[model samples]
Target: SLKIVFNFQAGFGILANMFLLVFYTFIILCYRPKPTDMISCQLTFIHIVLLLTGGNIWLWDIFGSLNIENDFNCKATFYISRVMRSLSICLTCLLSVFQAVTISPSSSFLAKFKYKLKKYMISVFLFIWSFNVSFTSHRIIYSGIFTNVSETKQMKVTKSCSLLSMNYIIRALILTVIISRDVFLVGLMLATSAYMVIILFRHQRQHKHLHNLSHLRASPEKRATQTILLLVVSFVVMYWVNIIISSTAVLLRMYDPVILSVQKFVMNVYPTITPLVQISSDNRITNMLKHIQSLCHHIFKKR
Candidate 1:
């Protein structure tokens, strides 16, 4: 069933996000992340909550065997799931923008506060949560379960819940704001990344005479930066693909269950791929794994 597929994807996404959240939290606890790293940590945790909540709704739908046509819980479940999801998207975009700002050049305005307000990171996260909470409360208030016509009467036999037209308009407005934020941050990220690349290229050339073969290649920061850039690119690509698919479905006034199932699957990739990106590029993670392997070998030898 379509519900099963959606549940599967949502479960996968939640599990992946949980892994990423734990990994990052370990990093943060073991060694305090740079102020910028805190943003990523927070974002990952937020995503875990989003995916878990969304997964619960789909799982409930798959198992409840309740008619959406007459079910209040069905409507509330979807409303909450979507609100959490949209909030996650918005928060991730904010994280990306924060990182881009942190890495910007000294001459840039964002750079002015980089070292000055490092203590405000917690407050910043609180603000992000507050924003999302206030923005989506109306979903809890205005949304409700509705009965659809039977298959012979008009639409399909399967029951489903949806927002009313007025609520949908509100959702569109909120989504537009989130989309605008994503676009602006994405543009800034691209510009900042390009600038860093150009600077690194020039530096690599300048240092060619002073360093040996390996040293002449990419610096650690350059490699790490590139990895983070790739992470951003992956997030952006996945987001836009989902947006495109969603937009098409909305415009055609055709909510195909198949496409929704596919969308859920696509959503899982971002969190799963994100951890691998960090692990592959981070010397700390590599060293941690190596340390664990050595410990295992030592214990085995003693046995």
Candidate 2:
């Protein structure tokens, strides 16, 4: 049952992210996209890589069937997975900050960032990718094929890849850095989310009062802000839950298969749900889908 559940989540997540990948690419190449859309496109791509690397998708079994397994494969897989996971949080935090600035009033200090975001968005993303890639590079040194299950110093990440123990001081320093990064990014996401919520409320209140209207629908900015808040909330909840389970496993020396399976499920949940949420809330995608459906219906009726 556990295996079945894990497969279901992994399969569904990959498919969802793949769809968004193509959709986002089309929008980016063929049309003018909102700044937030570009961030989301990159986030979507990161989710795809995370699902592919971190979720494993039975790669261990395939490697075994192929009769080829080595430290390089194990190390490369985990290293890429770690980098993608780091990128996930960093990009999500960026998304929240940009949305907050995008929705800020023209006179507000945050509004200045809106212009800078457009000018330096790609540079910011490149920096994030480089930082995370460097930050998690230690995985290459510490990760390898697990040859001895009895070795308590190794923590199993996948069926084949395990993290070898490092020097006590070095391990402690790495842990501190990772914890600091996660905390800082999560806190930033929450702060920006709160700011967006406040701006949204103020806008609604003033909009109603000034227009003498009570049943107004959400504006485009309001919808975009709400979508981002949802993403931030969901990402935070999943991150903490995964951290709890993985931290517990680490404390126990990371030998438990049950705990590992649970951790994978927890990790996959956020990526699986993220793209679905974005697709459903995105008016452009929804309208495009509707257009396709209508076009298909008209052709079928004529036939």
Model 1, 38-86: lDDT tens digits are 7667666666655654534455555466543344564456556666565
Off by over 4 Å in 1: 1-16, 55-58, 61-76, 101-110, 149-159, 167-176, 212-220
Report the lDDT of model 2 for residue 198: 92
Candidate 2 stretches with Cα past 4 Å from truth are 157-159, 210-214
Worst 10 residues of 2 by lDDT: 55-64
Clashing pairs in 2: none
lDDT score of residue 111 within candidate 2: 88
